[model samples]
Target: EKHLVLLRDGRTLIGFLRSIDQFANLVLHQTVERIHVGKKYGDIPRGIFVVRGENVVLLGEIDLEKESDTPLQQVSIEEILEEQRVEQQAKQESEKLKVQALKERGLSVPRADTLDEY
Candidate 1:
């Protein structure tokens, strides 16, 4: 069956289910990494994947009939990637401004990527 899988790292993959184990690990065939920016998306062929269960956030069967009816436009890989890069940069800039604002008010917020010492 065709399946759409969402990974913990915010990646979205779609492919045919080849195998699955009791541990929830999955094997996907003809996989594609789907990148979405705004209302547009692009699919990059990923071939096959053996995904660990822990990295999977969600998985659902795809309805073939409805799949083609998506309201989002499908764009070329290069276009989607460039858009993604711009979006990421904008987000990072906003985050920096937010942190700076908090600092100016004498408030300190831990960085998201930093781990607290035990």
Candidate 2:
């Protein structure tokens, strides 16, 4: 991903680099203080030179990983059938529970009623 680093001194550096030499290495641009770079999860410790690319101002950043096309996995006929059976079983169990709850509440559950009526 391309990222832009805006330094404390108000200068910005735009680049398409992964990381700096080291986690402690600071990058210096024109009129900008040494900008930190690299794997920082939270507030970067002072004197540690590792600024996350996302923390800086970026005009544009494209995810190269998302650009690659990959074929989706195919489901077998048996697997589809199994999934449908499980879904049907769950629906039946849910209806049973709903009926039981209505009985407990002293409410009459209508036979052959749609789910919306419940």
Q: Which one is best on TM-score?
A: 1
- The local distance difference test score of each candidate is 0.96, 0.46
Give stretches of model 2 more than 4 Å off.
1-73, 113-118
lDDT score for residue 31 of model 1: 99
Provide the TM-score for each candidate, comma-separated: 0.96, 0.33
Pairs of colliding residues, candidate 1: none
Instruction: Give the per-residue lDDT digits (tens) of candidate 1, residues 15-101.
Output: 999998887799999999999999999999999998999998999999999999999999999999999999999999999999999
How far does residue 30 in candidate 1 sit from its true spot (Å)?
0.3
Model 2 C-alpha lDDT per residue in residues 1-118, reported as the tens digit of each score? 4444564444445444444553323342221122222211111113213555344443334366753342433344455446556667999999999999999999977777556654
- Score residue 33 of candidate 1 by CA lDDT: 98
